[model samples]
Target: MTSILIADDHGIVREGLKRLLEAESDFEVCAEAADGREVLEQVERTHPDVVVLDVTMPRLGGLETLEHLRAAHPDVKVVLLSVHGEPPVVQSAAALGVHGYVLKNGCATEVVSAVRAVTEGGSYFSPSVARQLVEQLRAPRAEIPDPLGALSGREREVLKLIAEGLSAKEIGQQLSISAKTVEAHRTSLMRKLGVRKATELVRVAVRYGVIEV
Candidate 1:
């Protein structure tokens, strides 16, 4: 049997994914995590063969967790799921050695195929993601720009939460940081992005694929 760990911030999404994957006879969901931090913890405890990770979780995002997973558990496979199929995001996951990339809007069967493909020492990419990757490879190396590249991972997390309309205190609670720190990240994000208002921040976040609309 293939042990799987599903991670997503939304409990409903997690449950849905769990039920979908568990329907497969050979797949067993060993654990579930609400955020990237919990993902890491569950990974250590459950030692799943494959992890179905959502890209936009709170605290440590999927990319950050992928880095840690590659360092600590290179043998495990990862299939990244995201609503955004931006080139930079797909490229970043590719660079980090993700085994599969499945868009959230894709058919549920794609997720199962992704897990199976990765476990068999192969890779899979949703058709849209594959097209973006091909475009990326054919274009100039500097053709695509990632605005979120400038911000630290923590700052990106803060920006995402802010764009989601969470207060500084709420962001702090989720990240386990102080409200002051969240404010500091907000200020930094605004300054770095050359925006003067929170609304501008939201616009920038949406435009740059930091958060989905």
Candidate 2:
């Protein structure tokens, strides 16, 4: 059997994925984890051949967790999943030696293919993200811009809404935070992104796909 460990923050998602994998006669799911730390624990215990990890989770992020796994268990393979097709995050995961990148929106078949690819010692990148990587490879590479580092998750959320052209009141309503908090996020993004003007900030956020604008 192709031993597997599935990792995600959502119980429903993990349960669904587990059932899907179990249906495949060639695959065997050995463990499940709901966070990065639990991922490490599962890996240590199960030593599964493949790890399917979600990108976003509380505490240590998926990519960071993968790095830790590579250090301690180089024999195991990993396939990363994400909703965001952001270039920087994808690139960083690739550099960390993830065997595959599968978007959660993809069909279950794609997930299986990703796992098989990694198991066979080949890497996989989801179609959309792979295309982006190809374009970037053709272009001149620049120093990685960690412009979003200082911004908290809440701040990032606000910046994305702002970039999507949502008014502060609308964003505040959506996030359940006050309008004052929304403004504070904008100010934090401005400082972290080093933008002097609202237009400039929006432009930067849009370019990064942090917001829809």
**Model 1 regions more than 4 Å off:** 166-184, 191-198
Clashing pairs in 2: none
In angstroms, the error of model 2 at 38 is: 0.5
lDDT, candidates in the order shown: 0.87, 0.79
Per-residue alpha-carbon lDDT of candidate 2 for residues 51-147, written as tens digits (9 for 90 to 100): 9998765444676678888889999999998786887667767767888999878787888888888888898888998997787678766654556
lDDT of 1 by residue, 1-213 (tens): 999999999999989999999999999999999888899999999999999999887777888888789889999999999997877678778888899999989899999999999999999999999988888778887767656656776787788888899998999998899999998998899888888987799988777566666
TM-score of each: 0.82, 0.70
- TM-score (C-alpha) between model 2 and the true structure: 0.70
